[model samples]
Target: MKRNIVIATLTAAALATGGTVAAFAAGDDETATQRQSSAGTQVVADRDDADDRADDVNDDADDADDREDDADDRTAVATGDVDVTAAEAIAAALKSVPGTAVSADLDDEDDSGKVVWDVDVLGGDTWHSITIDPATGKVLGSHTEQEDDTAQVRAALKGSSVTAAEAAQAAAAKGAVTSVDLDDDGGSRAWDVETRATGKADQDWQVDLNSGKVTTDRSDDDED
Candidate 1:
């Protein structure tokens, strides 16, 4: 029961790291956190009940999605001089904040009038959103969000043998990475990568975060 809750929490954290949070909120909302906390408690209470556990996990995931959506809406557009690639941006973010580089993208801010790499990292119990100068690879700014599931995220990442950079390299074989998110695959955690290769269709790959294995590979063009 405890293990299940930990897994579920880590999974939610990974999925909620990227732009997905924008559809819901810009950052961690109090209501979303409360709801997730309640769901986690419910999971433990209903450990013996499979249906209840499943429902709780689903509810938790829904709340997480809402938060992620909110974040996505708040994320700025990627634009400007992009000399540094997404992979390089991830490297810079990881150096600044040691943990999982869950997501990264080019962001063009009208106010700043500068192109920046917006990267989200999960380190220990804190979620860090860092801004990097795409041209110089300099960390321009950053913010942190501490949530109830921080420990779970830390555990999941520390337990994983594969680093985010390693996962990106494995996925890079597909194409230039657009985004990389730590994701849960039916209790197994992996890095979800989207790549764009010149003269080829975009692709999605899943690399096992625990074993540095490419578990799933497919082309996005096929869906079209």
Candidate 2:
């Protein structure tokens, strides 16, 4: 009977140790699962942060492009206003002349804050002229002559070499002379005239009023 009791006690002790080992294994598995979950959350957060940074960079680029476009628009508007003022002045000057209709275009080459225009004066025909000013929209001087009336002016241009009326008439045949004035440029006689001419193309002419000669001839390219 004593032997039987000893065997029963040993079996009970063995069962208790096995139960303790099972509990420890369950705890370790739970800890490992928690660690894996934490690592996954960190990876997701990092990806979100990178996406936000990329969006910010794109926004900055768009803002810079918008500023540049605004600046270009402002510059164009300013240039257009100056051109309008110049055209009005030439039109006013031509109105003083009989049987002539005058129109003006801006000259981009004369950007020295100087008002320069390609003036077209049409009467019996067309005459082109260039008008210049020291200040924007202010007419300082002008040169103009005839284009189509070449034959008449060439014929009349003979005799005495230079006559204001004859030269004026030649200029008129091509178009019309809106303004004609004579002046001395550094002791050299200079004639300043404004005219508009027409051919296969419409153009403006600037004539030396003193010499009864054409100075500069400009076409539609000077307009916009």
Candidate 3:
């Protein structure tokens, strides 16, 4: 009977300490929740860091592409035999002729080993070919076959349905025009155009004055 009484007294003491045990358990649960929240925050931060790294990679690729394009532009400027760009050469030629520039090409064949820009201009009813030194942007000389070629062009236009401007536009499809001339292709009339390239020889394009058909010629010989 005495032992049972002692055991009952201990059970009473434990019941009186109920709030302390519950407080300790609540504190432990709160700590565990805080640790879980910290881990979740760390995971979010890691995802953000990953996203930032991917963006950096894309930015680097874009920068590389821009650099490559700039290098290509520089290479194109350096490959020309003349120091002047095609635009500058054309502008100088137009200042001398005051006409619509049809074509401009670098000609490295001067006897003095100097490079010149051969520009063709269409002004009024005549076509003018002006040569300019690329280094100085100075006019070297100019010539025109207007008297002879104009008469033939007029005669051909009288019989053809297509206009001169249209024929030139058709021929320009082959490439940039270096020179344009009117000539007889067998019995039919045609417009012969030479197209300029950066590193290659001028290409020949023929536009049929009557049909407005454009054709290419592989030969280096002039159609005249």
Question: Which candidate tops lDDT?
Answer: 1
Candidate 3 lDDT score relative to the true structure: 0.65
Clash tally for model 3: 0
Residues 1-224 of candidate 3: C-alpha lDDT, one tens digit per residue: 99999999999989868878888999999999999999999999999999999999999998986666534433434555346544566677788887655556555434344446677776667888889776677888998745444544455556666543455567655554444555653564566666555566547777776788888753445534
Measured against the true structure, the TM-scores of the candidates, in listed sequence, are 0.53, 0.32, 0.36
For residue 83, model 3's alpha carbon misses the true position, in angstroms, by 8.8
| Candidate 2 residue-wise lDDT at 129 | 58
lDDT of each: 0.71, 0.49, 0.65
What value of lDDT does candidate 2 attain over all alpha carbons?
A: 0.49
- What tens digits encode model 2's per-residue C-alpha lDDT throughout 1-224? 99999999988888888878888888888989999999999999999999999999999988876565433323433445343333354554364333232344434334343334455454444454546431354545544566654344333323424434344455555543433433332333343445533232222444453456665444335665
Task: Put the candidates in lDDT order, highest first.
Answer: 1, 3, 2
Error of 2 at 197 (Å): 37
Q: Write the per-residue lDDT of candidate 1 for residues 1-224, one digit (tens) a residue.
A: 99999999999888887558674574558678888999999987777688777889999998986665433322322232456767899899889999777677654543344456788888766799999887788999889976566555565676678766778778777766666776653465677877665556546788887677775554344566
- State residue 85's C-alpha deviation in candidate 2, in Å: 11
